[model samples]
Target: MKKLSALICIIAILPFSLKAQRTQKPPLHGKHWMAITGKPLAATAGAGIFQKGGNAVDAACAMLAATCTMWDVLSWGGETQALIYNPHTKKVIAINALGVAPSGATPEFFKNKGYNFPPEYGPLAAVTPGTPGGLCLMLARYGSLSLEEVLAPAMEMAAGYPIEAQTANSIERNKKRISQWPYSKKVFLVHQGEKREAPEAGEIFVQKDLLATLQKLVDTEQAALKAGKSREEAIMAACDRFYKGDIAAEIARGCQEQGGLITKEDLANWKPVIEEPLHINYRGIEVYKLQPWTQGPSMLQSLNILEQFDLKSMGYNSPEYIHTVYQAMNLAFADRDFYYGDPAFSPTIPVKGLLSKGYAKERAALIQPGKNLANAAPGNPYPYEDRQQPFQKLLDIREQWVENPGKDKPGSFVPKHDATYHSENKNEMGWATTKDLAVDSLYMDRLWRGTTSIEAADEEGWVVSVTPSGGWVPACIAGNTGVGMSQRMQSFVLDSILDPYNVVAPGKRPRVTLTPSMALKDGLPYLSFAVQGGDTQDQNLLQFFLNMVEFNMTVQQAAEAANFNSNQLWLSLGGTQVKDRQPRPGSLLLNRSTPDATRSSLEKMGYSLQFGDRTSGPINAIYLDRKHGSIWGGSSNNGEDYGIGW
Candidate 1:
């Protein structure tokens, strides 16, 4: 009788146990519009724009401006990469606002400085500013509002705004570096010579120069409009002022004074290109990402490979599932590190071949069933594109490097912004032996390097997803423009051995990790999403998409899901030495909540595991609920990412 009662008790608890747990934050529901971003105030800016009778593109521009002003891991001088879904055309378009290496940024220039890659910070690392022009182009082309209207929120914030703790603390912690540039020191060091030289949390940090600069753009636009220019022409006039007028003169002067390479010619020559995004069909859903210049296509490749597997049967977060995902990512990233680069440059990338399902299958076939493939090298995609392999010798050299990564000279890898953005505790550095801990910390820093994402959508079917980055804290403020210079030049490789396609060159965009994602089902917008980690952006995004599709989790649940990261790919940011960019094959980061059995199985499969409480992302996403005639918004609980829907 007692045994029967116990069985009944177990049966009674089963239903509740099987039910999904309540999320820490509720999903945002909206019928008219939804706006989500890295910072709460930035999302509020988007919401304000939405309420003011703006479309998704206008709202997104406002949010981008606000976030850049607020220094949400980016500034006005940073690059802006976006994927926008236009309801009118029923098409998705990509915006490539990535900055280019300035006039003297050749490989020999950096190699002569005794650096393997570009320096991690300072004026020397700056590329020509892209955000300003990109924002203007986006607003002028598709937006319903004027530049003044879209920039109002950001201009207000630029005049004066309460600084958040994260940015304030970052400024304080890196004050020594900030003090190196006179303009930067003037703007960021509000409490110079004090125990804390940066603005306190909640302090009203003012940037008078920045405000003046924004005012100049608005004034230029208004002047152009008064002169009978069309809205688009007026916006372009303001953009031209920044690139070719007095503003350009000041920027060039400032950059040169600070020992940077950006010239007025570089700025004037640069323009944001609207290109067709690359995509692959996974099951019935078509997903889109920026071209090879970004690491976006790697996720598509991973999805194509995983489509062949019975992922649902393997179960979510299971050892087999994680291993399979990891191996697929490894294979895709291997191609990314080798073949992905600015398409406008020489030695054309075999992108057609790389995105081929046949190519994915061939790569997927290399995955070991019971062990990690530690030496996964780049595969031949040229054949798939009907082209001959011209770099067979380079591929052989890459294979040798994969087998012996330690052949490169090892140096100390110090990631200055890790503490400021991620809030990593230095005390946790004691988790392993000093040497192992240093490697782990460096890998973690590279994996979780900072950026910010923006997602916005409207009832009219317009959607915008953006991943804008660079010019984080410890940034060098260029002249008196109050705009921090972009440190994106560091992502370039100084040697062909590191990345032949991404070798630093004048007028070439560095292959960046920033990527925005969008999905379409049956010729309609299904999901718009993005995240903010450097190398880990696509890794986290891949799992987030899978969580919603295969596992049938809510957008919010997927954003907060327990996803694992593979450290078996090249680092895109941080480190001045080649060793810092080398892959740490078999290293994996798993959520602390992972089952012990799964952990043991992964360990036995030759994986070196590391645990983290929050392993997934601060991913922001919007799912169009076509059936419900509403939008479902998801912002991860990991950070201050917030969304407003109404």
Candidate 2:
């Protein structure tokens, strides 16, 4: 009778527990909130900002600063881009923080010299940097906190802290390149406030020059606003202080001296263009992404194609399921390579035709059952052929000089000599679709592309989403900032991803794979988001969309549950190449942080696993639940520490 009574009582409470778990309110104290990234402190810093009355935009800005200070592998002074949705305005917005080539740049210049326009890390590599300008724009337009308030934590942290394990690893790995830059040595190598080199993790690494730069922005803004400048005027003043004024001139002069293409004109003319985001409808949910400059649109294309199938019945992580998705990824990736590019620059690009529903159907027909469409002909290969002429010559010779990438050689930056990348597989096979392949069995994709940060705001009925990124890194490292700008040539990889036949010519903005995405359902804002990790961004995002809309998973569950990876990239060092019946590359599997039942289940489903620190990129999102009067914010704890506030 006692056991029966206890069982009855447990049954009575089941509904309540289910309800609580499903609809529990957020910002709950004592609940273990999680975030993933390369640095623990930075993730903590991002979450802390969210806890401190900062919204998503504020949290992102805070995280960006922390990343700059801590994750020296990539951070501030680098490029960023994002897509945001505002419920109030009923629209999505985009911010382009991508850099541009100098006015003096021309394809002929490189051809005449018998060399690539920008030698990797060459002085002529600097492009117009837009990170600071874009960050300020988001804050000034939407954030309630002052720049000083938002940047305060970074300022304090930058004052003292040792180099982290990740930073030390990146520095040591890239030591050869670091040695080439005097500024990098002055800031990162030498100990803070001491002449000796800082030791590995726990030794203080300070960016005094960066702090000084932040201080100038704050002081100048305060003075300008106190002088009765309008908010817009004051913001512009601050931006100019960073871009066109003394700061801009100094950067421009350094770039010029370094043999970079950026000039005073590039900086002066450079501005973050607020453009309308490209959007598509998938199963009644509206999806918005940045236009051709990045891979976001390609993701949408894959989702649209997949919408034609019933993924739920296929079951989670099954081989058939994974194969179907891989096929979609490969198809979209092929289109991205052949047709996507900057609309303003690549005349052959078919942005309108590619995204059309009619076109999506045509592309979908190419996926055959039970076999691979490996090395298939492009969807519309003609338009791209003319544009890709100059870069094709380089591709023919790439096999002779490009060294294959390997995990053991993670420290090896770019290939310097001819080596068979496809034959020499150094990376793990991304997904379980193919067996009998080891790391050296597959080719390498250049890891340098897609240095990005995403941000969004939903304030005062206004919305903004922006993504900032560029083609290459360390265009020049600033000693004071401890940051490197990107040297993005209007080149082949970015364009080829969108339009394979398109020739990579000079002065063209390559089809960007850096896409920021937003979603709306039932005439209301549903989510604001973006994906990072180069080719992996699109693949992960496609799964995310299916989980939420097709399978009816909650946003958090859809994003968090998977063992994620991508194979859409080229088999070459920088592109994705798919062999017949061979699996794609870049799998982002969600392994058990603490091994148990989940691990066993995932392994049974054929996951080739590796452990990564909590800070994974590829996500950060917030949802506005109007009925609940609360904002649902979460970050992917799988990698980077990402968060949502307000």
Candidate 3:
């Protein structure tokens, strides 16, 4: 009788527990369309496009433009990586609009400057702007609306919008850097010499130059259309004006004047590539991500490794589950640190072997059951590709490189501001620091670097997911064009021993952390999702997906759920010195609400744990509810990310 009473009590509380887990935010429901992004106003922009009878592509472009205009941790000069699902073709398409290094960016050039890697900021850390051409290309080829129509919201914002505290405060905080560049100083320091140079929270901030530049593109497109050009032709004309015409000339002049290396020829020659994405079948769903040029494939690789385990049996957020997921992420990230890079360059990256199921099985076998795999190393995917490893010597010496990065290098280049910045922001950044862990507030800034994601879906079945970033605050304004140059150059390595495939070279794209994701079920769009964290992007996304598939959480629950991050991989950004990029093995970030038992277990497993109120994401996602003939949208509760559906 006692056992029966206890069982009844436990069963009574189960539904309430489940209800609490799913009630953090209400799930957005839509019958016709759904628009979700980093900001509420940006989502409204997307909704306006959808209301104008535009498809998912048009809405996504509008949101991208609006987010860039609002400086949602990105700008007009950033790079864009997207994955689109075409209902008609029943296929996922990849957009690689990442910018390339300019003529003077070479390994020897940076080494000569006494740099271990590229500098973290300024004109010297820039790549050719890719966002303008990319947005144009995506809008021209896949969208139904005109470029002018899609860019309307962004143009309005650029004219003058009430700036939010986040962006306004960021500008104020970095005023010294902004004041360094004449054009930036002129544009951003509206209240120069005031107590706060940047505009206050609700002040109307105007970008007359950006407004004029956008008007020029629209004017050029209109002219082309009046000349009997087709819709695509007219859009291409605007693209050409930006890259090859007078707009390009102004950008080049301003960049060079600011000590940037982007030349007119580089701008003219660069073009966004449309390519097939990579995928892996997990259970019945197919997940798609951009090629190796991004850190996206690592998520797919993790999925493959995790597939071999019965994750549901471990329970959600259980000690065993967290340990398993962390180990898998570490394994996948180890390969990303060494093997992943721009496939367009190099002795080709062995992506096929890396994504192969056989290779994943081999990697999965390396995970220890009772402890953290702190020293996870890259596996030999060469044999899986039926090819001998050409860089075996480098592979053998990989540990030594990690242990003593740039050991043989001659010079040091540590900026004085970095130390001061880290010291001041250490307690406020929300990351725990310890003697055993070398991570500081500055490292956390790079680790969780901001970006904005766009997810849109229409009833007709078009789905778009984008993670676009770069040209953030304290950005150097290129010229009269009012565009910031890309700081993507910092993502590249100067030494082949660090990453041979990603060594700095003119015309090469760097291995970036931006990744957008899409999953298909039964030949239909299942989920379109993305997030805005730097190295933590794929890690957060992996958990988000699993939360839905294995744990049966609604899209909103998954978006708001607690997720952990493994700092056992190389830092992708803000590492001016070799030591800065080194991985912090066994370091894990857990949600503050994590159970005490889970923490104790992880600690016993040789893990160094840190806690945060919100460890996972501000992920934005859209789920196609084919069974109900509707859509579900999820915008995380972590930040300014918001969504609208109708």
Candidate 4:
């Protein structure tokens, strides 16, 4: 009778327990740990690590490695950047695993080749890969697992994992390109030259060469350990093998043999750095992002500018919200076009000046409610400059390098931003798909390019947000290594002088599209978030953050919110810039969830609105309600996202 009564009591509480599991929306609540990755398999891998007593950092590494194996957009030879928030220290640190240009790299090199822009693929576009060293560094510093231990899951995954439809589609589309190289094809298409068909969704995808490459790093670490090295020392030696030793030599040789510029010295000299993040105080929330080299600070600048608006009162995705946000986006893009560049090549990046509150206020005054203004020019933030020289000639690099953005091209079938429309009703305005919008838009679809983003959090309040890009595309594998290389070098401009801030030169890093962000409120680490869309990354992230914080939306609701794709900046998606004259990029883009009435209102206001086919943003996030002591996590409903909590 006692056992029966206890069992009856447990059954009675089942509904309430399930109710506790799911609340407001897709962001499942939990008390302990949470991880949401770009793909389900990667999330499983991360969860496995977390279950084994690994902290957020270890799980993040495992997730990233698994993503690299499955997501063709990443490889062992790519780059990754992460923003880590340590709750104990309350400091968000930016980890730059981004590669720098080779020692022999020069802007004059591309210019002398008689090319208006650098090549988008192949060895010449390659940079010294920073991911290998960066991952090991993260493991050595924060993770409890050894480099070999954290990487084992990835090695197992690379050996053989089932491919998905998205990856399969990408592979089939690039079949011809990937077939050119024996090893590149081996990694993607199972039988190097024989089986040309794309692998089905359930087909096992094996990357033997990549597995070997990763194992070699472990082997190096093991050898170091056998030689009486400490765990940290062994990891450092493993990193050294990739950057300064045999691996560097092979990579350099490949670059040389393929008519590229990367030399061994470039790899040896390159070291990823940990730096202070650029932060802005937006409505009592301290938001942090990467440095200017990435499109990171654009978010900071946008938030600072948008801080003046009563966003909650304006309502989410309303005409006023759209108009205000778009104006702020344009202002931020104008500044990004002017000031963002490789921090190493350009030491005076005016980072502080650009992010200043007074500067944001001054720029905010430029937005007028009723009238849609023409392109906003970069503002004068010199008053906020604490550098040696406040006033400097704003070199017109855009005229030469960024000249072909085609901002004047038609952007939508409904009507242009020039607004000659007479109709005010919804039916008068014709509906258009993303493709239909593309017909009149200035932006052309850069065929099949996406990045990878991952986030992890533990009960201890330690959280991490990482964005990994530079997969280098379909067919280009480095020298003899089965692993591919990144065309990150394409981020450079062929200008060695005049533009001190972003001039492309040897040993100078390119301003990459990879930006990871974190947030803190009430002096406590709160959220870790990231996304895959290149230039649209920051814009998407901004919406996600605002949704959770301002509108009190659930994590999934926030991630799936209608995104604003502000293509106004040089977002540098997958190292490929749209090269044509048409309806230009930067026309305001909204996901399908935006009401047709809202779209019509924006159109009437002379805002050229573009439609995204799906209510999707390849964004993922992990939110910490510090006050509640609960964790909420969700991913973008793009099918690729996976959020797990326990």
Among the numbered candidates, top TM-score falls to 1
TM-score of each: 0.93, 0.74, 0.92, 0.87
The residue-level lDDT of candidate 3 at 91 comes to 87
Provide the global lDDT of candidate 1 against the true structure: 0.84
Error of 1 at 413 (Å): 10
Cα lDDT tens digits for candidate 1, 1-646 = 1221221100011234434655667677888889999887888888888877899999999999998898887898899999999988999999999989999999899989989889989888999989998899888998999989989998999888999887787688679888989999999999888898899999998999889998999999999999999999999999999889888888888889989989999999999899999999999999999999999999999998998899999999999999999999999998889888999875488889999999988998998897898888888998998999888998888777666665463222223344212223322322232113322443333334368899999988899999998888788888889898899998899877667889999999999999999999999999999998778889999999999999999987898788888878878877787776667677787787888899889879978666665776778999999899999888776677888887
Question: How badly does each model clash, as a count of residue pairs?
Answer: 0, 83, 0, 7
Ranking by lDDT: 1, 3, 4, 2
Error of 4 at 219 (Å): 1.7
Using lDDT as the measure, the top candidate is: 1
Q: lDDT of all the models against the reference? A: 0.84, 0.53, 0.84, 0.70
**Candidate 1 similarity to native, TM-score:** 0.93
Error of 4 at 294 (Å): 0.9
lDDT of 4 by residue, 555-611 (tens): 767876666765544434222223311223336777766887987787777665666
lDDT comparing candidate 2 with the true structure = 0.53
Q: Which stretches of candidate 1 lie over 4 Å from their true place?
A: 1-21, 405-416, 419-449
Clashes of 4: 7
What tens digits encode model 3's per-residue C-alpha lDDT throughout 153-185?
Answer: 999999999998778877988999999899888
**Model 3, CA-based lDDT:** 0.84
